[model samples]
Target: MHVTAILSHADEGGFTAFNPETGTATQGETLDEALANLREAVELYLEEFPMATRAAPFVTSFDVAVHA
Candidate 1:
């Protein structure tokens, strides 16, 4: 199964993650890195709490400019 992520930068030039489905977030460094780490984190989470899904990953990504 696959999930969605929303990544944003921190105040100090790092990264944070948001799982839209579960409304959870975490901090990381880069988007690629964050998604990589998030995948593992989600895996571990699901291992502890399983879900019902019998399909492969369906990932979608895009770039957006942030305004201050």
Candidate 2:
């Protein structure tokens, strides 16, 4: 099944990966490793609690105004 992954830089080090579809998260030293870890985590979650058919997530970004 196809899923969405959101990655971000960790404060301590490395990267953190998150899968919104399954609400799974993992961390790794690199982007590739983070994705791999996220994949494995999502697989395990699905094995235990399978999900029904759903549409793919629409990812976008918006700007917010910052006041000084």
Off by over 4 Å in 2: none
- For model 1, residues 15-63, the per-residue Cα lDDT tens digits are 8777765556677788888777777777777788887875655667789
Q: Top model by TM-score, which number?
A: 2
Q: In candidate 2, what are the lDDT values of residues 1-68, reduced to their tens digit?
A: 77899999999999999998888999999999999999999999999999987877789989999999
Error of 2 at 36 (Å): 0.2
* lDDT, residue 45, candidate 1: 78
Provide the overall lDDT of each model, using Cα atoms, as 2-decimal numbers.
Answer: 0.75, 0.93
Q: Count of backbone clashes for each model? A: 0, 0
Cα-based lDDT at residue 4, candidate 1: 76
Q: Could you estimate the TM-score for every candidate? A: 0.65, 0.90
RMSD for each model, in Å, please? 4.5, 1.1
Deviation in angstroms for 35 in model 1? 1.0
TM-score of 1: 0.65
